[model samples]
Target: MNRCSFCNRSADDVDTLVAGAGVYICNDCVALSADIIKSKPAGPKRTTPVWEGVDDDALLAHLPRIDAIRHQVDDDLRSWVGEARRRGMSWDRIGEALGMRRQSAWERFS
Candidate 1:
């Protein structure tokens, strides 16, 4: 089943949802976000990348943080796929979700 991109609630759990390109948001989240936007003024637009102004030395120093985040996300993906397998979701479905071939998904995660 499809899930909200922000709240992670499945389609069966929400009353309404709108689909965007490769993303989904439910009505509850839309209403909550609208309230948040009303309460806080928008900030200035960021016309440049966040890392654009950083010096080479400072950027190199951030490599460990980025690496750690990547590792954590990798671990999370493995666990999520493992749980989906336990729930009897087919390898084809998993591969489709991951945009890979079923054999590749099984070889990677199984």
Candidate 2:
């Protein structure tokens, strides 16, 4: 039986299960999500401004540090994906977990 993609509850556990976009959400989660959405503000959203203080030379000097961080992030992502696969999670579920498309996840990790 398939499990709720969000809560990992088995199909037998939830009162109802809804499936979409390669994922499932149980009834309880759905109701909670609806309530949360209802409680949100209706005002316009605000976005963070990009930093403009760093100059070209400063950016260039940080290239090595940026590259090291990128490598570390890649290693962590690979490790997480490996562990997820070992735990019997599907590519679709893994993609959902990582907030990416299933094909993107497979292309990056597989």
Candidate 3:
């Protein structure tokens, strides 16, 4: 499943997502962005650099969530490929969807 680039919310968590060349934004995020744009003053400024305040403890805490998302996405991909094959889709097309060669896709997912 795809996740919003800004909020990290998965596709399952949001109603819809606007996909772009290499990014996705969930509906909730899109609304938030629109609101932000309309109200222009912006949030308060921060003195710290991005992630500079993220200690090892916080990083370690987020690791499992990241891993879970990765595993879920991988499982979704495998199931989607299986379904596509069942529906008479070609390996070449599957490979194209994955941006890989047919042999590579087969070798990886078949």
How many clashing pairs in candidate 3? Answer: 0
In model 2, the Cα lDDT at residue 2 comes to 55
* Residues 1-110 of candidate 2: C-alpha lDDT, one tens digit per residue: 65666566678999998865445679999998999789878888746543366778876876765555445456657878988999999999999988999999999998
lDDT of 1 by residue, 1-110 (tens): 56666666668999997876446789999999999878876788558997899999998987765655455456668878999999999999999999999999999998
Q: Which pairs clash in model 1?
A: none
lDDT of each: 0.81, 0.76, 0.81
Residues 15-95 of candidate 3: C-alpha lDDT, one tens digit per residue: 998775445778998899999789777678657875687999987877776676566567667878999999999999999
User: What is the Cα-based TM-score of model 2?
Assistant: 0.48
Off by over 4 Å in 1: 1-44
Q: Local error of candidate 1 at 49, Å?
A: 1.0
> Clashes in model 3: which pairs?
none
Taking every candidate in turn, the Cα RMSD to the unseen true structure, in Å, is 9.5, 13.5, 6.0
